[model samples]
Target: MGGRFGSPLFGASIKGFLNDRSALEGITSFGSFGIGITGLYEYHLYLPGVPGLRPFLGGGAHVATGRASAYNPYADSQFSDIYAGLDGVTGVEYVFEDIPLALSIDVLPVLNFPGRIGLWWNAGVSVRYVFK
Candidate 1:
């Protein structure tokens, strides 16, 4: 699991590759604000001679049912309502050759529908244990 930049949310993400260039990720997060789940689709771009390094781009959606303290001004600290949003991800990752591990750093910008329409920055770093 990894923590977010602007908030105290900690999330667990699992990614599965569909092909050499594409993958999908499912994420679950929890914090003082509440708990949330996100899903994303990613496309990997290879760098020549860099066997395990790649840059990726993707988009996804999230559904959350709890209080959140983003740009919501309805409540003093948070909004007690169900939230749905669109999210985008861009990142670079490297998989270790000798070890079953991967490391990535990414920026996830989210737009809360029916709420915050403007994108908010959400940067994070994550490590994954690859199962062969």
Candidate 2:
């Protein structure tokens, strides 16, 4: 569940992720999927010197249910981990003047706590339609 709000230069996201559990853990043996929700606030700095290009920065929170590997001196096991943490985002976007679409590429780095205490990166491209 994800949607974009606001104008092309600035926006917010209400989104969720359904990810491959193994991919999330950076392993191949893990089988399952993970579900999570995220909220982000973004601000874009448009360069007047260069039209149609904007660089952005954002911060947000994510909460999810997934499997993460827990390590011990004696044994390591996969366990249910809660992903409740903060994420920082940075990206660049280009607005198409002929069309109502804005294309962006962003990288999100997360720090989890109370469950999986680690850092992970979620990097992807997104397309948004402008209402105005």
Candidate 3:
């Protein structure tokens, strides 16, 4: 589990490797206003000299439902909103040797529409416990 806080978002995520260089992630996030779910496919590049360090780029989509506190000008706080968006992520992850832990720093840019077109970006740091 990790905190991907663009706007104080707390969520849990599961990551699985598809091959040596590709991975997938499912993320569920919640805030005071609502909840969001996202899926991403990433391609990782390992550095030649840096062990356990990889940088990745990915894109996916998200579906969210909730009320807007102030983030969306179109949605009122009293009502709930259901929207979908496209997401792009780029980050670096480091896995510790002899420890089942990974640390990541990433940025996500999202575009949401149907209600309105909203484009924004967020950066966050996360610590993940890896289960083997």
lDDT of residue 102 for candidate 1 = 86
- The reply for model 3, stretches above 4 Å from the true place, is 1-6, 73-77
* Residue-by-residue lDDT tens digits, candidate 3, 1-132: 544545546687778888989989888888777888989998999999999999999999988887876655434456898888899999999989899988888888988866877786756676778876
Which candidate's TM-score is highest? 3
Q: Which has the higher lDDT value, candidate number 1 or candidate number 3?
A: 3
Instruction: Give the lowest summed-lDDT range of ten residues in model 1.
Output: 68-77
Tell me the tens digit of each residue's lDDT in model 1 across 1-132.
333333445678788899889999888877666677889999999999999999999999988766645533222335566677899999998999999888888888888766545555667777888887
**Number of the candidate with higher lDDT, 1 or 2:** 1
Sort by TM-score, best first: what order?
A: 3, 1, 2
| Backbone clash count for every predicted candidate, in the order shown | 0, 0, 0
lDDT, each prediction: 0.76, 0.53, 0.80
Per-residue lDDT of 63 in model 2:
70
Candidate 1 vs candidate 3: which has greater TM-score?
3
List the candidates' TM-scores in order: 0.84, 0.66, 0.89
lDDT of 2 by residue, 1-88 (tens): 1233221112234222133111011111112434456666666676877877878777878676555432211111265555477878
The local lDDT score (0 to 100) that residue 28 gets in candidate 1 is 84
